[model samples]
Target: MSRVVLRRCIVRGRIQPARTSDVRAPGPRATAPNSRDGATPRHSASHDNRSRTEVPMVSSSVGGVKSPRFFYGWVIIACVWVANFVTVSINPLVFAFFLDSMSVDLDVKRSTLVWGITIRMISGGLFAPYLGRIVDRHGTRWPGAVAGLVVGLVLIGFAFTSNIWIMFGLFFISGLTGFSIFGGNMLTMVPPASWFVAKRGRALSIATSGQLFGTATFAIAAALLIEAFGWRWAWAIFGIVAIVGVVPPYALLMRRRPEDMGLLPDGATSLPVVEVTSAVASPTPTAPVASATHREEPDFTVAEAWRTPVLWANLAATTLLMVAISPFLLFRNHYWTTLGFSPTLIAIGVALDPFSFAIANIAMGFFAERVPIRFTGVIGGVWRGFGMLPLTLGMTWPGSVVLHNVVWGIGSGTTSVFQTMMIPDYFGRTNQGAIRGSITPIMVTVSALGAPLGGYLLDAGVSYIAFFWGIFLAVTVASASFFFQKPPKHAPAATDPPTRMPTST
Candidate 1:
């Protein structure tokens, strides 16, 4: 500076790190510019400095080199995945594995225990709407955390209790407290609907895949635990795992939606606006048909969605399928044993369902956006119905046993994904939790009867064939009805323009 030399400087949006030896004194042209007023012109000096530097500025949308490194949506998905894996692994799903031990130790009938499940379903149905509304307004974090903690405490209490009344009370509390599979489903599914638009299907599939894996892992682990330790210790262990695993992740990582993180759905910078054209009939045969375009989707309110046939149809169809599958699933171990299969064979066959299911879920994540979700549902349901037919034929054939488990598991996995995705697809994300919650009571009411009905058949000396055949018929009819299903058209309107509905979620 004392020598009036130019050294290292920031020039043209880049750093020019000049060596000390390379520094040069300003020339006459750099120091001065020809001007009538006898002063250096500001534009001439700036132009001279610019001519000395050659680096170009990198253009960016926000004047930065790059955007943020991660999407918060994936963090939400990972949290949901962990929560679902832990919650599903501990209660209700793994409970079935320990049922026989619980029945023997507590001197309670298996049917009585089955009724406890029905109570769980009933309680869950009753509380679903209120809980869903809570999710809608407040977000899933508080409800998931608090309910998960309560469920864990109840499970730990379940380990020490021998009274059926106490057990019933615990089951009720667990249902209300979000330990049930129903609660896990609600918790895992609702937030993703708000977080993603384009990637919703993939996100749901990935999250639910954890449920499938948990089903397999926990069922096997329960069996091992019951054999090594007692069922009480096993229950206590599961309760501990749930508390340590599920609550913290959901509380720490879950936000209501991408908007809460200052991000758009699917990490998009802008929302997608779809345009549709309505056809108007011509006055003359030769005249060209008039067409009108519109910009809105059928984002129905809870009342409006309930009024639509599409919602009701989907509900009815889903209810029938659940009714068919629930009993078979609850009684699968007993059914397989009655068929004279060895315990090892039975275990292998049972494991196949969740493994196949997990694989199918992963596949659906990639392809769900491409196909019509309704068609996927119908096809999967039909395939599952077909898979159930092997049970109708006496279980003497191992080939049939293997076939049924693998095929039915795959179908069930895909259908479950569609069912979850369809709600947000048919209804907008704004009221998804509540809308699904409103329909849940009816579905669970029908499903609650399934286990009890199966138990009654078993107690009454009805063969597994009779119960399974009845299921096959119900599933067949329900799946068939879906073939005719379509989104209902909006009534002709003056101010609003009619549009074709989107095909997938």
Candidate 2:
């Protein structure tokens, strides 16, 4: 003979009733679900009558797993990596690969065809502010998905268009969406910044380094595709990849901020709320008191940040870098072709660039926190100047080309990492997206002129030496400017929030 009894059972912060025998003591961690499919067994008399306490069952999600064991932020990094990897293949890198073929097929001069790319660059610059504002206002998931679609469709459209005017229009639309910065670029950088403070440099570097991987893999793939199929088919294939490859990851894994995951930045347990008050003193005032308290720094408005010196300095440095690098991006393949390298060899050399970029990117991320970002820019700038000058050496030796890619890749790597880290380090993360957005147009506008300017010079019969030498001089001056850059003083003073573990919710 047995009597039934209802006992209190607490599971996943919810209290219910069960037979006293079915309950088990709470262990170090919740017990695994009893069912083979990893579901919690319903509390019932028939299932278990011998146990006297309730066993805490681990929570299961859609995939039949408990909560993620690793930091969710790294998951964000991985998703962004894939997004950049697929999206970039349709942009100018691959376009550069297809330039000569497209011009010949369309019966257009090389200089005239270059305008399509120029249009895209200018459109990206013009639209950046608006898109950046959208990112700051909205979350990244939808914009990234939509942009992926736009870029994919545009690439497919490019395959069918032979008219120069239509090419310009297609490129313009793609620039508005295909360029990562205007589309989902901010999503990748901003989310990571929101999730980390002390380790932000490393996190940002790791995420942005995805560009290197995309460049390495996609450049080789694009060259190979163009070799096997016609240029039009190459564009079509890249388009399909962009549409299929980019959107799913963001839809599933992308999180806008750490709080969404019930976590704090850098795996913090609690967010700090700091209070700053002005104390009147005759000689000097003491720093704000932030003792044993969670405090947030004062967020600067976009207008306020614009009034600072640091913003302008960053704008100038980045814009100059764009001017220096733009020509190479547009003409690197053509430059190699003229140097007597086969398309396959050129592809191999270009693929090697990312390996160099990856090394510098990771190294910079690891050390960025330890060093002044301005110095990082200086090092990158000096390296770029020398790296660019070598392409003018006219060495047909394969080693010279490889050497050029390695030096330039390593040098250019730090430039991007510094640009990203500088914004948050100088200004707090509160308005990071907006500040970066405002600075973007200035850089892109300068870069937009770079390719056309190079084309014009080439049209006038100027040698690659002339173009490379001019860029080298410009880069040297830009590198020297980093030494004069100081953190913004005009904006509201903000201190780093104290680190503390979050309280268990």
For each candidate, the alpha-carbon lDDT, in order, equals 0.66, 0.66
TM-score for each model: 0.78, 0.79
Candidate 2 lDDT tens digits, 1-505: 2222322221222122324444344432222331111212122112122322222222333222224456687887787777777877755565678778888899987778878767887787777777777766776778878877888999899899978898789888987863554322575677777767657778888887777888888888887888789888988998898888767877777777765666555654322221112222223212211111212222456887788776787688667767766666778778778878887777777877777877897788877766667777888887777677557666777677778888888887876667777766666666777877777767776777777888888889888877777778888888888867765443223342223333322
Task: List runs of model 2 lying over 4 Å from the truth.
Answer: 1-69, 181-184, 271-298, 490-505
Q: Model 2, residue 184: what's the lDDT? A: 26
Judged by lDDT against the true structure, how good is candidate 1? Answer: 0.66
Q: Give the range of the ten consecutive residues with the poorest summed lDDT in model 2.
A: 35-44
The per-candidate count of clashes, in order, stands at 0, 14
Residue-level lDDT of model 1, residues 1-505, one tens digit each, is 0111121111112222322333233454332111111222112222122112212223232422222357787888888777777666444446677778888988977777888778777788778888778888888997888877887887788889989899889888877754444522577789887777557778888887777777777777777888899888887887887787778987887899765665556654422222222233323212111111101223556886798787888888878876766667778777777667765676667767878987887787657666556666777787687678788876577667678889988888877767777777656677888888888888887777877887888888887788888888888888777765554443323443333354322
